[model samples]
Target chain A: MSNNYNTDGDRMIDCFLNLGELMLRAGAEVNRVEDTIRRIGHAYEFERVEIFTINNMISLTVISNDGRVYTQTRRVSVAAVDLEKVARANELSRQICAHPVPLEEFKARIADIAENTRHYGKRMRYIASVVSATAFTVFFGGNWVEALISGAVSIILVTCMLFSDRLKIRPIIAILVSAFVMTMCVQGVTHFVEAATMDSIIMGNIMLLIPGLALTTSIRDVITGDTVAGLMGICDALLKAFAIAVGCVSAMLIFK
Target chain B: MTYLVQIIAAVFSAIGFSLLFNIHGRKLIITAVGGAITWGVYLIVFTQTENVFLACFVATMAIMAFAEIMARIAKTPVIILLVPMLVPMVPGGDLYRMMTNLVMDNSGQVRFYGHQLVMEVGAIAFGIIVISTAMQLILKMHAHITEQRRARH
Candidate 1:
């Protein structure tokens, strides 16, 4: 490790904070985000690095061996499950740990990563949503006709999600609206086609609404001893589930 | 024949989820296989014991083990594979049923589904903890033995 690299404290702090913000916004778990920040600090020859992360914020302090201290706090409000960006950021941290680079180079690399990685396009996402809903109908033992109905309902749900994303609606509200739309469509279709089983179709399509990622991540966090993060995740999942149920029930009441 | 259909459905569902998560290329197929294995084990266990909780636990263990091994081989985080694969086993249907029962004022059925939901979620959580801890221990032991061998050399 190079001990006297003459690195500016402010630039190092900016780089570290940028990495932390990118990872958190990309939906890396709290523990992983903290660990990455610590590793990055250590790689840059920081004497001590401390990080405290909550559900929506991160605070970090890095102390150089020369007794200079730099502290920064980032407020992260927009968190989506983008594992690809998380993977990219993880790889960047690993690279930083393996080979220390100049601040300018590091900033440029981060910029490139942020720009290059992209989410699946809107059309592909819609197709994936439809496919999962239709496949789940079969998994739930629904017949082919029911699968078709579920897939059609999923198309509407996906469009609603896209529109909600454009309008910057809250996730809870978006989920509720999507669930209501799905149930209403399913019910309307069933009225015309007497053979369509409403229960199976709704049940199958509802898989899209379930917070499986949050539930599993929360359980993993709790088991790993990050009780606070885990609890936050659980509460989020439960609230989303409640919203979905309320939406479905309200739609049923109106349609029935 | 029916089991085959179920397994294929699980595969398709997993692939769809992986795509939604932007998991591309070879990792996508591997994730689908992981899902198939989980659903296959789940069906076998459920059929033999008629116990949903145990079935979910055993299947979760299988998926976790598969994920750990795949993560090691692919050099990717375990979560990339684990999250998409576990989607099939989630009790989404039971949750929907529980809410429906509540709305219908059927307290008995609501309680029934609610209990099942808790047990299923608990069983899966327990399975994850057990497998993850065991894998970490095994990795540590392997590292220690390799260090000893290097010293002897």
Candidate 2:
């Protein structure tokens, strides 16, 4: 056990940092990220653990029993909602706390999680987007014909979004462009189909663009007392909302 | 009958959103059910009171409870379930209407929709804060009791 303790501090720090980075990039809020990291440190018998996380970055320090300190900073640039990864990471941390694993095995497990791909394929995502748009139409009291139009428009919008994502375009730009394309498509479709209200179709498809998740998470964070993270989340959500509104209104003006 | 159809649609929409968020396996079903419950409650309350804020508050509380229970059962974080389920209750429609009214130069309609949007969003935030704070307190109490019991032993 003493031998195990000798070489494990650096490796454990690396493992913890990797785990925190994965959770952060998977779109976890700041409080969860900080809590998970602190728990993992405590489980590993670290003397002290201090973690500070912002919207896109995490900085941490861990001190061992022998006066050794380890500090690391990781930048998490991507923010995609992959709940499976978040769930998997959360489970891993819990397991680490409950049953201590060796350094080699822990590193391997973290690697496996980091490399995990999404369960659904691109085609499935497109289909799901269409289904969601159609359902929103019905929920908003649109008829079957209007729902169908919204579904078609959703297909176009998702395609544009995917293409923009591939090009690594800024998120706000991508949202603005997609919203513009969505409204333009709706306008064209309205000219062709009689009695198809533009409001319902646009509203249905635009639901996909609104930053609902971000807004909710921000509020939850603020209420939980992480005011800075909450403010950042709120700003991000509002920026996206503004981009979408500008896109839609610009399209409306051009079409009118 | 129509309410049933709408409920089904809400479920489908939630499943689709779960797929988009890459939530898989049995958790998908739980999240979908959460969405259905939220929408069902919202629809009933909205129809009775015709007040979006009250409906949103009640629906948000219901879903937060659902998410908390599901998280404990599945041993997953509550956010994985909460975010997707909350999608249907989001004030997307009001935001769009607010923007549309602005474009048409309808100042009165714009103000009306804008006010509604703010109230609904505020209601959602308020509901989440209440439930989250309550749950945190309960968990703390449980922890304290366990600690005291251990000390007695």
Best by lDDT: 2
In candidate 2, list every pair of residues with a backbone clash. Answer: none
Question: Fraction of native Cα contacts kept in each candidate?
Answer: 0.66, 0.76
Q: In model 2, where do residues sit more than 4 Å from their true spots? A: A2-11, B146-153
Q: Rate the local accuracy (lDDT) of all candidates.
A: 0.87, 0.88
Among all windows of 10 consecutive residues in model 1 chain B, the one with the lowest summed lDDT is B71-80
lDDT (tens digit, per residue) of candidate 2 on B46-138: 999999999999999999988998999998999899988988887889889999989999999999998998888878888887888889999
* Candidate 1 per-residue lDDT over residues A1-256, each given as its tens digit: 4765334877777777788888778777788889988998888889999888866788888888888888888887865567787778888898999998888899998887677887788889889988999999999889999999999889999899889989999999999999998899999999999778888899888898899667777877888888888898899999999999999999999976
* Candidate 1 Cα deviation (angstroms), residue A74: 0.9
Writing each residue's lDDT as its tens digit, candidate 1 over B44-152 gives 9999999999999999999999999998888777777888899999899899899989988999999999999988888888888889899989999999999999999
Best-performing candidate as measured by DockQ: 2
Model 2: reference contacts kept, as a fraction: 0.76
